[model samples]
Target: MTKTVQLLQEQFRHLRMTEVANELPVLLRNAEKMSWTYQEILQEILTYELKRREEKNVEKRLKWARFPYYKTLNEFNIEEQAALSTRQLNQLRELNWLDQQYNIILLGPPGAGKTFLAIGLGIDAIQRGYKVVFSTMGELVQLLKTEEYIQKSKVQLKRLREADLVIIDDLMYMAMDQREANLFFYLINHLYEQSSIIITSNKGPEQWVELMGDQGITTAILDRLLHRVEVIQLNENDSWRLKHRSTIFN
Candidate 1:
């Protein structure tokens, strides 16, 4: 029996069914105990291999996403955000707009759940088999600046360009010179119409010119980004972080 099992495992591995090879013993045992038919045994083996492949694919995509943290849409507190309603949030989760390559701009003060919402949507997208990438504006700029000289930057930017949804956090948080603004514009141009974007920022598009420091570049960037976009303004009330801060004494 052991020799037979080993031979079967070796054959499965040679056929590139590594997952099935590893689980062959357990599956064989279950099949024997349950008296599964030949057809049932074949179905079980194919299903198990496909399921394991999907699980591994999801894991690979999540790692490629490089999210600061994993937070699902269900974890979001809709009650805390007056700007967005439950129905609207559900609509976003449906991802119809994402499928149409529409952009989403999340505007609000610090800790207004802009980043949290963006991250949540990104995670949801990943689960749905969409390629997603997360990068702060600062990190994106750095990546753009060094992409030519740094192999790591090149790889990261390649992933960004291939992503279905790109989330840029804290956009226009600092002023950028001509070169930086130009680099940023080229990236947006490449992604324009080909992919959707979710931008989280304290300042709106109207205020982006001030930080970009170049009217022409800012206008060009806005032209592509606002072409098919939804702007959601979050609440201006007390910071969500402050309201939910953990007390040391407690």
Candidate 2:
């Protein structure tokens, strides 16, 4: 409420230090109460601003990612999913593969944790300051087809192109026509070596050609995806969703 405090806040706003500006009053009160030195106060303000900015950046990236749901690696039942060990999960979290632009292919049947795992990795990547985008195979195809004409689609595709990692869920869930197959291939080609990819699919690579309906297109797609990729097959006998489904009577 003091004139000096108001002036300081205005200066911070002018410098685009909005986070510090808003918290300046509280910070000053804490400093006074603690009898903090000038250096300590300055360090605290800078740390707070940096932390808030990182959090906001994560939020923005998460919005752009467009995950169907939020899930963390911690929530994944490692015991239930026998394929990926805790050590493997920890390694994945290190994100060295992502930094090296390596791709990940998660294969499993319906209700398996493939999608969940992909989303968890994507979330972790975002928190670590990487841009990520998530779209189902069907949604990606539609977006690619419409990008030329639709403004929203263009925006979405732009984000996808600029992302450090892209997650495509339910790949080859259905057969694609010649045109659809071509579009998908082109997108994959564009992202090849430029960004890491995480793909979740119920079908294996051998089965992908059948769904694509074009051996040549499938071959080209596979070439880029398999060039530097880690394939993990989730072979859990029971579906995680089915096991956790709530019953009305219960």
Candidate 3:
């Protein structure tokens, strides 16, 4: 109702406050300020809103949902994902595969969270705007083998040539027959030196050569993959998806 109070409110509406002490208390009357403590009101009304707006502009640089759990990277014990030493955590965090010039492999057995870790990397790359293709070994081989062998299949090969990262999960389950082996070699050769691969397999790198056979092709694939690679071996025992017999029987 006071003319001075009304004028003060109207004039200050256009001026955004840099500091609260100077601008705030004057704008809100002493009676209105009585509802709560001054510091609580000031932080909520001013600082919180401003910080939220600033974060919106840089949201893309932030990590994805899976990335938060990575803060707890562990190499031993699996209440959730075991406890990873700082050195191991740093390697996974750097995600050299995202660099596109270096490949990486997560070597482990069934239920060792190998696939989980591989997926985490794929999500991290996706958050950074890199395209990632994720597929199980059998599925990928079967899909690629579907079409009769033809030179034209190189169209699909072009896709691999352009991918930034290719995640092949469950790769050690079956021996590769001639057709599947050839298909695998072609894709690996095409992606060689151009894209990075993130593979999760039950077998270690040494075991893969004999399984894939044809040393010439295997050697080429191995050279590119191992040339610049981070091999993460999870030594945890089979722990995931275990059910308590008591609960199950009951």
Candidate No. with top TM-score = 2
Winner on lDDT between 1 and 2 is 1
Q: Encode model 3's per-residue lDDT on 1-250: one tens digit a residue.
A: 5676556445545454333324444436542766657785665557644654445422432321212233222332345444446566566657664675788788776777777677666665655566566667776677678646655444444444576878788778777877788888888878777778888888887788666767766777687788888787775675453521146452
Q: What is the lDDT of every predicted structure here?
A: 0.95, 0.94, 0.63
Better of 2 and 3 by TM-score: 2
Q: What number of clashing residue pairs does each candidate have, in the order they appear?
A: 0, 0, 5
Q: What residue pairs clash in candidate 1, if any at all?
A: none
Cα error, candidate 2, residue 58 (Å): 0.5
Candidate with better TM-score, 1 vs 2: 2
Which 10-residue window in model 2 sums to the lowest lDDT?
235-244
Best by lDDT: 1
Task: List the RMSD of every prediction in angstroms.
Answer: 1.1, 0.9, 9.5
Between the candidate structures 2 and 3, which one is better when assessed by lDDT? 2
**lDDT-based ranking:** 1, 2, 3
List the candidate numbers ranked by TM-score, top first.
2, 1, 3
